[model samples]
Target chain A: MKELLNLFLTFARIGALTFGGGYAMLPILQRELVDQRKWVTEEELMDYFAIGQTTPGVIAVNTATFIGQKRKGTLGGAIATLGVVFPSIVIISIVAMFINNFADSVILQNAFAGIRVSVYVLILNAVLKLWKSAIVDKIGIIIFIAIFSLSIFTNLSPILFIVGAGLAGFIAKRQQGVVS
Target chain B: MIYLRLFYEFLQTGLFAVGGGLATLPFLYDISDRTGWFSYGQLADMIAISESTPGAIGVNMATYSGNMVAGIPGGIIATLGLITPSIVIIVIVAHFLNKFKTNEGVQGVFYGLRPASTALIAAAGFSVVLIDLVDFDLFRQTGSFIQLMNWRALFLAIVLYILANHIRATKQLHPVIFIAFAALVGIIFNFGLN
Candidate 1:
């Protein structure tokens, strides 16, 4: 029970404070979960992040669920997911009420102009970090380049690119006799 | 009828925007372009405000767009629509993650997703730069090489970019600090919307 409460409060705090969404949340998760709580090792957290990125959900929520399941099973996963989402639910509710004012506010407008640049920088750093982790082989690098070109140059939607890449991976695994 | 369309559109956005909130930008842009529900300029403003404030960028933008389209209910419905998949997926995965931890097909799908996710992020980053930083119309209308520039924003962006990269004690510098700094500059310079 204590562990479950702790999981909720900790994730709630993370959800509340974190801005700029999932990528920004990564280092914080490292500091809190890895450094302070010692809940998961750095290597494990990295693996979780890699999986978190590839999977079809929010990274923070996914991480919370992974950690929660690790700590206390399915119930814990539910609690942790709640904790992560609680902040957004509350914050967005309040913002929704006064959002028009927020949109017109001078201070916010200026702040955003600066923030826009930082967002780019943060994402660039995240890409570099993920690249170091994900692109381990010649084939991976080639796939990265091909996907990047397909996304940037052509008018193709990313979903097609993802499906095509998955087919490629499946084919490669079959050819290499790795999956069987 | 309209509400259903709105819900379905957002549902598609929620399911497929794999790289997170920013990846939803292009889809929203396309929606705006197709339906004429919102303008490109409004989308740009949404990006600006969404990036500046707190919470998930995708959710924030959805709320704003929804509010614009259908008031408070629209905002609520859209947000719910966007996050529903994440919630459902997390819950189901939590239930059975252990049995599937090392499955080869799962691993392959994840591996395939990595490059594609990167592509989505890169594409999002590119579109934002195109919309926010480059003022293509200034060149068309002014026909003057000098007036064709968004000099203030460009300068601010460059300076912020450099400072963000080089400042070694960066982790200690909260995002609010930079946000506040930018606000101060904008206030002093009166960097009003053009």
Candidate 2:
């Protein structure tokens, strides 16, 4: 029960603090989950991130689910996911009630203009950090370039790219194992 | 009935909006087109609010849109629909796939997935830059390169990027500080001023 509460509180803090989205949550997740709690290693966190991206639903929720399930069980997963989304539920519900008044404010508009620019930078930083760990081999580089191009230029679903790359890697690994 | 529809729609979104939170944008746009529960303009507002506020953008968006449709209960139901798939899948994986953690095939899949995820994120970052800094539609209509870019936004982005990356003090500061600073500058400069 204590562990469940801890999971809820920890992820609640994470959910509350994250501003930009899933990618921007990386640093905070690292600080709280990896560094402080040692619940998961950096590599495991990265794996969760990768899995979260490929899976259906929001990456943050998916990740919270993964971590929580790893920690306790199904119930833990539900609590953590609930914790992470609780803030959004409360905040957005309030915003929805008074959206008209808030959306039209000039001060808020200008603030968002600036905030949007910073969000791009935050995402860029995340991409760079992930790139360092992700692109380690020739195959990795090829997959990166292929998916990057497809994502930028086409309307193709990212799910297809992820699945295809996974299959390609599986095949390539199998071949290497056979030869060596 | 409205709540049930909300649940079903959001469940579909949760099942298919792969990649990340932003990937749900297309689905939301579709929902707007089909249901008219919210207008495109309202969807834009939801995106802005979702991006700026704490928590996942997807979750915020679902909550906002659902509330618009059927009040607070609708929001709760929609969010629950969205996360149900994740919880179910992760539980199955956690319980049954523990042994596969170090399996060769699984490792290979992860190896490939890591880079692919990175690429997708980089592409997402690129589009954010395009949307925030460049106005291609404006340029196409006006046929002026200078008119295409929001120079002030670009300048602020560059400056903030440098500060966040290079300066020791600013680098160490929480990202919320930068976001707040940008907001203050935007207000003072009257950015986005028509």
What DockQ do the predictions score, one after another?
0.36, 0.53
Residues A80-133, candidate 2: write the lDDT tens digits.
999999989988888778765677888888877777777677667767777787
* Predicted candidate 1 versus true structure: per-residue lDDT over B1-194, tens digit per residue: 76777787777776666656666765786577567888765665566556566665676777778767887667767766766666566567656655546776766666666666666666656666667667778878877777666678678766765666676765456555665666677666666564
Give the Å error, residue A125, model 1. Answer: 4.0
Off by over 4 Å in 2: A1-73, B1-58, B61-71
Output the worst ten-in-a-row residue range by lDDT, candidate 2 chain A: A154-163
Question: Which has the greatest lDDT?
Answer: 2
* Candidate 1 CAPRI assessment class: acceptable
Inter-residue clash pairs, candidate 2 = none
| Per-model chain A TM | 0.68, 0.65
**Top DockQ hit:** 2
